[model samples]
Target: MRPQCDPSCFVADHLKKVPPSGIRRFFDIVCEADDVISLGVGEPDYITPWHIRESCIHSIEQGETSYTSNYGLLELREQISELFSKKYNVEYNPESEVLVTTGVSEALDIAIRAIVNPGDEVIVVQPSYVAYVPSIIFAGGVPVTVSTKMSNNFKITPEELKNVITENTKAVVLNYPNNPTGATMDKADLEAIADVVVDNDLMVISDEVYDCLTYEGEHTCFSSLEGMRNRTILLNGFSKSYAMTGFRIAYALGDSEIINSMMLIHQYTMLCAPIVAQLGAMEALRNGNDELDKMIREYDRRRNLIVDGLNRIGLECFEPKGAFYAFPSIQSTGMTSSEFAENLLDDQKVVTIPGDVFGEAGQGFLRCSYAASKDEIQEALERIETFVNKT
Candidate 1:
């Protein structure tokens, strides 16, 4: 006879404190179902452009499959640097200030680990991405949340920001054109937040992965703000914009010292992003703009379709200005966010993410990604309406 061992002893204490992603439970349910319409995952419906895919194939055929510099291919870095300079007026040295990462997720993780010390507080604006809180916890830093309100279009104000600052506060994590809620910050909104960050002498980790998906207004790069260039780690990548999520290539731009610190962690853990993906990304930056524009136009169309349909069904959806999600209040159904999502999936064969998974403030709401085709969005909307009417 053998004695059973406790798995807890093998896991790290910080990891044990964290819960599994709220998004994963629904994913498992989805995988088991048949003929289901889903609005859960935040992925593009479009395929990678042929030119970009061809670039990767060409690179492999040429036998360029070995590792590059830990900092990544200089040509890709230079392209990234040039894009930032042309689009957002922010400049970074390709050699020192740019570090190509496995993904924006990796860049985010390494940035958190590079800066946070034990007992330090990192302010996370909520209803935020599911990864932010866990990443902070893993780095031995406390996550202090400041909830953004729907009344303010989910944009955090300087007043809300000031309430959370303390002597031990080290950084703030921001995701505008946010996930779960497609709220975006205008220049004035970000400028107000910038004032608070400067006054407090805090660092910022800005994830602008969805920058190219904005529909209503220009995407403001946070690092472009006055005095913010040096203190901000600007994270962006090809995942959302170029329909290259599978490639897992992204980059971080910041002061050389911070980039160097993140590089130290990257060289040991990730080494460098896949060279083939890097080659694909280089092609994306150079020649994929036309295909990207077409996809954006289609997403805007779907955004209008879903938001209108949700409101017509009495769900009370706010118009999302950027990204591809439609967050609608389920309060009229008299069900909690979780109850509504679960019951809808069970009753109508449609899938959505309960908003509370993003944060406590997300209760009474649901996140429906409009990244599916027009036909799928229409069918999901109809199914949701049927479920809502029956309730």
Candidate 2:
């Protein structure tokens, strides 16, 4: 029998307009190909440090697998509070001002929902992460994009911030030690942007997932600035720093009122993050510094290797100051970013991300992650050179 069709369908209107993320398509294609060297993925190639993994197993053995309190385990929240205080010079009362989430990804979702009403404007700087735009749209807020240029090293200037602010601006999404671009804002840059933020009475959603992975300088927390703490929702996780991407644990810190509001949304949406993962994250916070230091040293080594190798191959790349990515200009190859990525994979069996996948500002470039093995990076660079020379 034919199914009866109704004019009123089940799918939400927002779902119809939201396009699938461009980053995933190349990832899927690369997984299906043989002998491909992938520098496309942003995740660390290393396994989660042994001790961190052991903590989760130990928790399970102790029969600690039940759902935690709706916000999260008190122990984990307290650990997060201590870590933030010690590392970033930010203070938060764990019980009232922190919410554990299923990765910085979910923390961002909850923040968007909590602060942005329908038709509100959420400002995002370009060449940023993929999730910000869709998250804003899903929350019924309009995304106002401010394009940043490579000439500026991809950092958003205060003048740029000033131009974007409007009465409807609810929040600005800040991704530092940024993905894809590998840009980090220094203290001066933060102060300049904070001036605009403060004057406009705008909120900041600071995504600092790559905070611990910085290379050139120490990461400066926006929340640590004077008067900014009350207006910033700081998002961080164990994914990049501790090589715990699969742990599915992250946290958000903000004013108590904002955190409480987010908790209400989080409880209804997800109930809680996995209890076992929270245990893993707790151990990561408590005693994972030595392992994290070792990992960061290795990433720094790879970062220099890949950047130098690409430059030697006649590809002009900005020396990344943070994160594990190299955003290299592929304009010399006479191909668009998409064409360069596709041709490199098809012809050389080397996979990288098209910069335009990030945004229009990324059109003439490609993002190569240095989170792979040293040998893998060397091989990928050679393949890229071969492809570039021949084409």
List, in order, the clash count of every candidate structure: 0, 0
Give lDDT tens digits, candidate 2, residues 312-385. Answer: 99989888889999999999889999999998888999989999888888998999999999999999999998
lDDT of each: 0.94, 0.91
| Residue pairs of candidate 2 with colliding backbone atoms | none
lDDT of 1 by residue, 51-137 (tens): 999989988999989999999999999999999999999999999999999999999999999999999999999999999999999
Which runs in model 2 stand beyond 4 Å of their true positions? 1-3, 6-9
Extract clashing residue pairs from model 1.
none
Residue 266's lDDT within candidate 2 is 93
Taking all chains together, each candidate's TM-score versus the true structure is: 0.98, 0.97
Residue 131 error for model 2, in Å? 0.5
